[model samples]
Target: MLGYIARRLGAGIVLALLVTFITFALLSTSFHDVALTILGPAATPDVTADLIASRGWDRPLLVQYGDWLIHALQGDFGESVYTSLPVAASVLQRLVVTLSIIVPALLLTVVISTFLGVWSASRGGIVDRIAQGISLIGYVVPGLLLAIGLVVVLAVQLKWLPATGYTPFTEDPAAWARSITIPVIVLTIGGVANLAAQVRGRMIDELRRDYVRTLRTRGVSTGAIVIRHALRNAGGPALTVLSLEFIQMLGGALIIENVFALPGYGSFAFNASLQGDIPVIMGIAAFGVLLVTVVNLLTDLANGWLNPKARVH
Candidate 1:
């Protein structure tokens, strides 16, 4: 198990490096005057040239990429060309805020979806059908549209929550929850729906297996059979889907963040791209790549633990 984990970690590191190189190459080739874009038209030509020179854009692409990698390894994400602040610091501050929102939202999603999926699967009638229908709607609706709709109904018309903006938890925990509640609801809807569907499908399959039939033949209690026997077997696939969705949520929160006016890595990356802050953009991309690689590696390890026979080869 340790060897397998070590190999997966090594592979994840290699994949992250590849992602960094690709992002660096693309940004270098596509944006010749990244510093100029950040400085705007008011800056003098000489000042812009000096900014470019300082960023070492005139150097060969490989040299620039190497410098960026070295700085990144040292926890120096480079200074934002637009704000003149360290990119790592700016991103980290925002990341904490984003995680505060996402973590609770993810937990809520897992609890709600797991219960709904199990309850629906246990019943084989209209309740199941309705649950399926709700899941479909949640899956089909785009996150941005759902966020806007939530703001309109819950924040504007009903005045139940803040429309958009973040309040620090230190200031007022209640207010922070109130401000982000709607966005969290919007963000979790899709994840819950997807997880519910996956869970329900797995449960259904597990219930039909020969072991379940044998349990039924032995007159095993339905609750015990479902909870202990079936659900445990179903957990492997459900966990896989959940982990993938959680990772996707980190990247996919951009549109929802914009709609809710939350300052997060997604918003930061978006603005950086629009302003051509190549260093910041690349840093964000690298961070995302690292997150995804780590998540996938963990997922693989989890699957191995859940079904050791499958990993025996």
Candidate 2:
């Protein structure tokens, strides 16, 4: 298991490097004047050139990329060309906000989806049909739309919670929950649907397996057969879908964040891109790539643990 973990970690690092290089190349090539864009067009050409040169924008692309890579490896992450704030500091602050919301949403999604999925799979009647319909609605709704509807109903119409902005949990626990609850629900909708579908499919497959039948024939209680026998086998593929959904949620929260005005990494990246902040944009891309790679590695380790046969292969 240790060896497997090490190998996956190594592979994740390689993938991160590749992602960094590609992001750097694309941003550098596409943007002709990063500093000028940040400075605005009204500035004199001489001033713009001087500003650009001061930031090493006059350097060769490869040289710039190399320097950026060094800074990134050293945890510097450079400064935002637009705001002049350290990229690492900004990202870290926003990450805290994002994680506070995302973590609870993830946990809720897993628990709710797993229960509904297992129950639906085992029953397969009107209850199963109702669960499927709900899942379909969740899966089809766009995140931004869901967030808007939630804000309208819960914040505007009902006046039960704040519509936007984050408060630290330390400052006021109730306000913190109020600020994030809607956004968390919006973000988890698709994840819950996807995970429920995957879990249901896997559970059905497991229920049909010979081992499950053998356990049933041995006079084991249905609950014991499901909890001890089927659930373990169903977990392997369900875990894969769950991990992928998590990574997708991490990378794809930009629209929801914008709609809700939450100050998260997604919002930061979106603003950076709009302002043509090349360094900040590249930094966000690098962080996203690293996150996805790490999630994938963890998924592999989880799969191996759940099914020892996978480890052998």
Highest TM-score against the true fold, candidate: 2
TM-score of 2: 0.93
Query: In candidate 2, what are the lDDT values of residues 228-274, reduced to their tens digit?
Result: 76877888898888888787777776776777788998888888888
lDDT of 1: 0.82
Residue pairs clashing, model 1: none
Give per-residue lDDT, candidate 2, residue 254: 76
Q: Which lDDT tens digits does candidate 1 get at residues 23-121?
A: 888888755466566677688888877877876887898998888899899998888876889887888777777777777878888888888788788
Q: lDDT of model 2 at residue 72?
A: 89
- TM-score for candidate 1, please give it: 0.91
